[model samples]
Target: MTQEDKINWLKENEPILWANTFKIAKGELSDKQTMFCCCGKLATGLHEDNCRKFLQQVKNETAKRLQEYIK
Candidate 1:
């Protein structure tokens, strides 16, 4: 899927992840910052895999948007 598609999917299927990923992508949050879980707990080792995947997808989408804007 395209970056936009992946982002939309994340937004629909995972709102919390989408919010944090978008914030990081937009430079509102630092890469070193930790994301919190929906259950009000720290999402360190518990959600690392999914969080990493979502962050990567958000970064990819931001890069694509930047490239398109440059073009």
Candidate 2:
């Protein structure tokens, strides 16, 4: 999927993931923080995913669309 597509997917399918990731990116949340996620596990973590897929998509962004998804 394209970067925008991946981001949109996260926004739609993984809201808590999206919000916390942005928080980490903006330094508003600790990278070490852990919270319950809708993924039905202990955490989606402070990051999006471990595959680096999302990171590869957003890391180079100079104007990263920090839009928090709400569904």
On a 0 to 100 scale, what is the lDDT of residue 23 in model 2?
A: 54
Tell me the tens digit of each residue's lDDT in model 2 across 1-71.
Answer: 56567566777787776666765563432243356332334445444554254444343231254433422
RMSD to truth, every model: 9.9, 10.7
TM-score of each: 0.36, 0.38
TM for candidate 1 is 0.36
Question: What clash count does candidate 2 reach?
Answer: 0
Candidate 1: pairs in clash: none
Scored by lDDT, the top model is 1
Q: List the residue pairs that clash in candidate 2.
A: none
- What's the lDDT of the predicted structure labeled candidate 1? 0.53
- The worst-scoring run of ten residues by lDDT in candidate 1 lies at 62-71
